[model samples]
Target: MLLTKVVALSLSFASVWAAPSPPPQSSEVLEVENAFTASKTAPKFKSLKASAAIEVYWHVVSKNSSVAGGNILDSQIAAQITILNEAYSTTGLSFSLAGVDRVVNATWFNKVTDGTREQTEMKRALRKGGAYDLNVYSSGFVEDPRRLLGYATWPWDYAANPQNDGVVIHSGTVPGGDNAPYNLGHTLTHEAGHWVGLLHTFQGGCNGAGDQVADTPPEARPAFGCEVGRDTCTADRLPDPVHNFMDYSDDSCMTEFTAGQAARLTAAIATYRTQ
Candidate 1:
């Protein structure tokens, strides 16, 4: 979710943290696989009646932050949780804050990775929850925006990179914080959508498997700002879903997850996150 005046690919995935990519390339949908089939632990998702609130633990990292103490306030984090819950309130799923931990490291805070060196070290040392609780890490910057704003590990990626099994976001995207247009805290809402199993509404750009979900219309690219009544994929009968939480729309523009996404979340949780 590289949210400038316009939306850029979440991040360049060659190095670390795969989110939405640039215009020509695919979005995070390219990097994320269907973890529902990749899970080796929990059984396949079947029952829809199951409802459980997921626990999320926070790890705040800072050293050279532009902010005062480089640490986000507990109240801010709580408010972010409230926003997350609000977005997913209709789904049979939800998240509760487990706790918050902080680390003041300059080197780790500066560099994020994809199981290479420094990023792996950060995750190995700081990561907490196993397959259940969501471990969220906040840092100074993700190092590249021609690619990303935040990135999350797919539920299946946890087994291979257990330590890196969470989402990393900038400290300013929290509500009433910095990061305008995106200051509304929907960045977490979007990335967490990926953490579960959702994909960008414009996933395949009107081509191949679009986002792996039905009902969400396709777009040739990520939406910029809140362009309502805009349809990128005109050939398809359905209009582009800029208002979808998974798309790169502005925080204020993004609102809902399709029923397909809800079902996918249920299955994804059952298959990969059930603990």
Candidate 2:
């Protein structure tokens, strides 16, 4: 979840929007993911097949014809899908745009903040498909002071919060849009990481099993810019994974997910989402 927007001194498009705060990871969520990780070979468990197909249901919520007001083009949406596919290419996961619905609603377009009543109402009315399906909503966050780029519900949270089990992103964050440093369509990639039950690479900092992934080095905090060779938690002698999609790095900075992350994502989908 995006917490607050940091304004940088540089006026360039890439520097206008700073990295967002890492999303909160609860103990219960960690326990669930750990259990799945441990039970990969259990009798009831099965590995997600290669190139597991994930259907996407896109809901475009807009105030009017103005693209600045949340109305985005179909070409932008298609480019976003391409970006998502390329980012997760090595994770044995594939995303296909199954459906797209565009709505011109003032309230839902401008006022749907995460965990708010408006968000709940909008999702309940628009959410489609099952646990395996990904529902994406593109809207404006004018009502949110945080200016969130995006937010998502974990796969395990789907049962309890069926209506909220999806991802919501700022409309301008799509490709060729205004929210630079994030306009490359990587905000969805980060939130979708949360959707698949992957915690931030910086989660738990340098203390516990950071992100429950061994390959990604524990980061003391989220990396802002393209800080090459940045080592935050040097105790492990490993540099922070500023290039991982799970970090709060800029779109240009984020590149790939670790192999452990891919394995975890496979297990998560097999355990929680396949049902």
Best TM-score goes to which candidate?
2
Q: List the pairs of residues colliding in candidate 1.
A: 1-10, 9-20, 9-21, 10-20, 10-147, 10-148, 11-147, 11-148, 12-147
State the lDDT of candidate 1 residue by residue for 158-207, as single tens digits.
Answer: 56657667887767777876777777888888878767766667656788
**Could you estimate the TM-score for every candidate?**
0.83, 0.88
| Prediction 1 global C-alpha lDDT | 0.69
**CA shift at 232, candidate 1, in angstroms?**
1.4
Each candidate's clash count: 9, 0
In TM-score terms, candidate 2 sits at: 0.88
Per-residue lDDT over 108-138 for candidate 2, one digit per residue giving the tens place of the 0 to 100 score: 8878866678888889889999999999999
What local lDDT does model 1 show for residue 160? 65
Collision pairs in model 2: none
